[model samples]
Target chain A: MIEIKHLKKSFGSHHVLRDVNLKIEDGKITSILGGSGSGKSTLIKCMMRLLDSDGGEILVNGKDITKVTNPFRLAAVRRHFGYLFQEGALFDSMTVGENVAFGLSYLTDIPKEKYPAVIKEKLAMVGLKEEVAKLNPSELSGGMRKRVSLARVLAISPKCILYDEPTTGLDPIMSDIISDLILEMKKKIGITSVVITHDMHSAFKISDYIAFLYEGEIMLYGTPEEFRKTDNPYVRQFVDGSSHGPIQMKLMRE
Target chain B: MFTAIGKVMMNWLDQTGGAADMVRSAGFWLARSRFEFKQFVLQSITIGVDSFGVTALTSLFTGMVLALQAGNTINNIFGDPIFVGTIVSFSLIRELGPVLTGVVVAGRAGAAVTAHIGTMAVTEQLDALYTLGTNPTQYLVIPRMGAFLLTMPVLTVFSNIFGVIGGYLVAVYALGVPGEVYLSDITTFMGAKDFMHGFIKAFIFAFMIATVCCYKGVSTRGGAEGVGKSTTGAVVTCIVLILVLDYFLTAILAAFGI
Candidate 1:
């Protein structure tokens, strides 16, 4: 289980996450859903120690990694988590196979001869063919890039998976494909997963629990079923994808 | 007005503090991490080998111009142009060779490092690297630093030789001076310490350019516009710092009786 306590992060005076708290249960999917700038991404970054919290503690299976400053020990903790970034974030310099082989090449004790096989195995896991591994990220479509990113993540064989805006730029069909993959990952591997996305359909379809972050705090966190019955107008507005709601959209006025 | 000044001062202090922090971390990582030997060698090829053409041209032209111009000064004083070789060799070896290479490489390689690393930062690749348990400092900064440290001095030596040859061409063929006069003067005026001083400057310039450029890169925020801004900022910062560092390093070296 991963636990985030009183998590606070700010940029200058504008606090992005304030007093946010949540517990992510082991071997379950927890989708952190929020509107733009609602701090869902920040929360995930804080948990992964990509961005430090101003005031918070993230206990990963009982160890608080924010305080783990030793590079080797930090790497040991980080090795257990796989991250799929918002834009796929494949290295531009390397081809798909090289990107997939990166972590294992640098950080692991894997034999040099097995790299090609390992790369192929991870690519196959993400529904990518071995031939596609030779292609650069620029050659792949957005969906293909995301899948390649997923393959790269799986290359490390992490204990937890963190996905930030997993379906951001993909078509609806592609989004559904990613959503399905998320579900398949959970069912098969049974790893702890934290997904940050505003796509409620993907969130509802894949998440066992949903966390609605607003103005740097968890305004609502419960099962998908609990969210369906909640009276909170802001939550309702976001879930329904309606323009008229409690959440106001600011515009320029003459 | 006082408050506004104070706010500006605060921002300056903040940025300086951040740069200092990155320097300290980069230094620590450079010390602690296992040298990625392959990366160091590849970067040596990239930073040293690739930039050879432009660096050579700069050295050759600089020495030629010094011969053409300064030969006149010696002619005016001595009634002959014999001392042109000595002056040109001395100036090229002690100052112009390393400084020119540093400036040119700062524009070429420094901007490249910033753009590449800045693009990675904006695209969340750095964050991804961190999540994959890779230290960005070790993977990105250290190997590049090592490459620069090893190659910059070597490049300086090459630059010095090319520069002297340029001066020789101008003096012997263009100015109608004897080749033996040029060669003998070089042996008389130039020594190991002059060459060592220039090489030492190359190392310092390499260190600053790598650190500043990488710092600008890693601190990039926003998006594509941020990457552009960081790249531009890096090049400008590198040029200015190389010039400023040249003066300070020279002064420091002079103080040590070099």
Candidate 2:
């Protein structure tokens, strides 16, 4: 379980996260839903320590992770959290299998002889063929790259997985496939998962608990059913995807 | 005015803190690089093999030109053609060989390293490595440094041999100097110290070029345009520093009688 208490982060004069507090239960899928510039991604990044929080306490399994000072200990903390970047962030020079094996090689005590078998199993789990493992990221299609990235995340067997806009560039079918994979991984691996996305369908489909982030605060937090039933104007406006509503798009149009 | 000055001082201190963090990260990477022996060897071979043809060709031409120009001057004054061999061998081994190899490596290998690493950095692959419990500096910078350090002296030796042969062809075959006299003069003129000087220079030049290239590459920002700029900057800085350091090294060696 992870606990975030009184988290505050600011950049220049803009407060990206403001007095935010939340708890992520073990073996549960929590989705943070918000439009762009609503600080969903920033909140996730801060939790991962990819971005520093101005003030906060992030406790993982009853330990304050923010106080980790040693390099090895910090690395251990990072190893517990697997992040699937928005862009797939695959190493172009490495093949799919090599990319998957990268984190495992560093973080685990697995024997060298067993590495290939482990890589094969992980790739197979993500529905990637053995032949595709040898091909570089450039040769793979966008959907294939995302699958490879997912395979890498799973290979580490992380305690928690953070997905940042996982289905952003995919077609609807591909998006559904990714969403299904997310659900399957959650059920099978039984890891605490936090997915930050603006896609309502993805959020609604995958999350056991939903947090609606608006202007750097959790405006509504509950089960998907509770979120749907909320009478808050902001929540209603976002759920309906209204063009003119309480939740406005900050667009600059002449 | 005092308050404004105080703010500026505070900003400078903040910038210094960031720089300290970058240095600390670099130190951590340097330690990690020690374990990646295979990567260092492979990268070294790749860098050396790719620059071989160009370094050899440039050394050959430089030797030919040196023989042609200096041969006329030595013959006009001393009337001994054997001196042409001595002059070419000494100059090639002492200065031209290592310096030319450094320049060629900078243009070929250094720019490539910068561009490749810069692209990885900009695309967030470096960040991915960090998040994956891998040290980017150790994984990236150390192999590059190791490869350059191991291959440079060997490349310098090759450059010297090829350059001497280039001069030999110009003198014995083209200008009618006897082969025996040319060989004997080269053996007599080329001392162990001259060879050692070139090797030392090669090592220093390689270290500087690799460090500067890797630094520029990993530090790059913006995007594709930024990578291009870093590549160009790496090559230019490497060349300038090599020349400057070569002069200082030569002077210091002379003072120490080494």
Candidate 3:
């Protein structure tokens, strides 16, 4: 379980995250739902310590990780969480097999002889063929790249998986397939998942709990049913996908 | 105007500090034996073998031009080609070879490092490495640094050899200076210390290029345009610094009687 209390982060005067507080329950799928540039990614980056918080307590399983400055200690904390980048940041220099085996080579004590079998197994788990491993990331399609990135993450067998905009830039069918993969990961691996996304359909489909982040703070935190029934105008506007509301979008024409 | 000057000064200080910090971190990892030898070899091949043709060509032409000009001037003044080899050998070994090789590698390999790492930076592969419990400085910067430091001096030595051959060809064939005189002039006038002066400069220039290029690459932001800007800036800064540093290094080496 991860607990974030009064987290604050800013870039100069531009307050990207302000007073964010939430709890991510263990073995559950928690979706941080927010529109573009709403600090959803920033919140996760801060949790991962990819971006430092201005002030906060990020307690992971009763330990305050925000105060841990030692890189080795931070690596120990981060070892439990697998993060999937928005664009599937696979190493372009490596083959897909090498990419999948990368974390295993660094983070695991597994014998070198077992890497091929493990690579095949992880790629199979992500529904990719063994032959796909020989190809470079540049040859793969957008959806395939995402799966390869997931397979790479799963190679480390982290306790939790963080997905950043997993369903973005995909066909509807591919998006649905990715959503199912997330569910399958939970059912099979039983790992906790935190998904940052603006896709309402995806967030509604796979999330066990949803947090609505608006203007850098959680406007609502509840189940899907509760989110649908919420009275808050911002949450309502976002949930209903309505253009006319108190939450206005800045547009070029405006 | 004062505020603008202060802002520029702050930016300079920030970048200098950042580069120093990165080197320190890389040194820490290196001391712990965290680097991959395979990466070092690969980067060495990329920096040395891939760059040999251009470095040799540049040095060859410079040597030929130096011999041609100096031989003609001596012939017109004293009615004989004199000290052509001495002038070419001294200039090429003690000054031109190291500086030219440094600039060529900076423009070629240095730009490439920045571009490759900059793309990785914008694509979040650096962050991905962190998530995989790997340090980018250890995985990326250290091997490249080792490769540059090891290969730059070797390339400079080759450049010096090729340059002397170029001058010998021009002095003996084009200027009618005897081959024996040209060879003897080089052997008699040039010493080990002259070669040491350039070799030391090459080593220092290698460090500067590696630090500047890696710093620019790792800190790259925005997107493709940012990578372009960083690559250009890295090469330009390296070339300018190589020239600027050569003067100071010459003075220091001279004081030490190197």
Candidate 4:
């Protein structure tokens, strides 16, 4: 389990995350739902220590990871969580099989001889054929790339998986397929998941608990049912997808 | 004006600091022996072998031109193209060979390194490496630095040899300076110290190119545009530094009687 207290992050004067406090329960899907540029990704990056928080306590295993400055210690902590980038972020120079085996070589004590079998198993887990591994990431479709990314993440067998906009840039069918895959991973492996997404339909379907982040703070934190029934005007505006609300988008004028 | 100047100074300090930090991190990983040998070999091919053809061509033409010009100037003064080979050979071995090779590699291979790594940066591939419990410095920068440092001196030696041959061809065939005279001039005038002077410069330039390019790449922002800017900046910075540092290095080496 991970708990964040009064997390604060800023880019110069413009604060991206301000006083964010939440708890991510173990072995469950927790979706951070927010509008674009609403600091959803920032919050998780801070959790991962990819971005340093201005002030916060991210308690994991009864230790404040925010204070962990040693690189190896940080890496040991990072090994516990897998991050799925928004665009898959697979190595373009590597074959899909090599990409899947990359993390295994680093993060685990898995024998070199077993890498092929592990690659096949992880690919199978993500519903990709063994032959698909020989191909480059560029040849894979958008949905396939995401699946490959997930397979690569799963190859490391992380305790928790962080998905960043997993369903973005996919058609409805493919989006639903990714959503189902997330659910399946939860059911089969019981791995903790923290998905950052603006896709309401997918978030509503997969999230066991949802946190509505508005203007860099969690305006609402509850179950899907609770989110649907919430009376907070900000949460209501975001949930209903209504344009006429207090949640106004800042636009740059040319 | 003051604000703009302050901003520029800050930017320079920031980049220098970033490059220093990267060098320290890469050094830490290297001390732990975390880098792979296979990666070093692959990067050697990319940084050394891939750029060799262009380096050879550039040095060849430079040698030919140096021979021809020296022959013309000597002929004008003494009514014979005497000492043309000595001039060509000495200049090529002591200064031009290493400096020209450094420039070629910096423009060709160094830009490529920045572009490849910069593309990865914008694509979040660096972030992905971190998530995979791998340091980008260990996986990417170390091998490239190893390849550059190992290959630069070797390439400089080859560049010098090829340049001498070009000078020989031009001095003998074009300028009617006898082959024996050209060969004897090189053998008599040049020594190990002259070669060492250039080799040391090549080694230093190798470090500069690798560090600057990798620094620009890892610190790249924005997107494709950012990659372009970083690549350009890396090559430009490398070429300028190589030329600027060559004078100081020569003075230092000369003072040490290298």
Better of 1 and 4 by lDDT: 4
**Colliding pairs, model 3:** none
| lDDT (10s digit) by residue, model 2, range A61-174 | 889887777777877889889988888889998888889898877888888888889889988887888888889999987788888998898888999999988999899888
Candidate no. 2 TM-score: 0.89
lDDT of 1 by residue, B16-80 (tens): 78878887887787777667778778888898866788899999998999998887777778868
lDDT of 4 at B131: 94
DockQ of each: 0.75, 0.73, 0.88, 0.92
lDDT of 4 by residue, B1-258 (tens): 999999999999999999999999999988874677898999998888777998898889888999999999999999999988789888988899889989998988899999999999999999999999787899999999989999888899889888988888899999999999998888898899988898899999999999999999999999999999999999999999999999999999999999
- In model 3, state the lDDT of residue A209: 98
Clashes of each: 0, 0, 0, 0
Candidate 1 per-residue lDDT, tens place, A70-110, comes to: 77787787787889987898988899998999888656789
- Which one wins by lDDT: 1 or 3? 3
Chain B TM, per prediction: 0.93, 0.88, 0.98, 0.98
Per-candidate TM equals: 0.95, 0.89, 0.98, 0.98
- Tell me the tens digit of each residue's lDDT in model 4 across A1-254: 89999999999998999989999999999999998888999988888889999998999877889998988899988988899999999999999999999998888999999999999999999999999999999999999999999999999999989999999999999999999999999999999999999889999999999998977788889999999888998888888888867775433220
lDDT string, candidate 3, A160-215, tens digits? 89999999999999999999999999999899999998888999999999999977
Worst 10 residues of 2 chain A by lDDT: A245-254
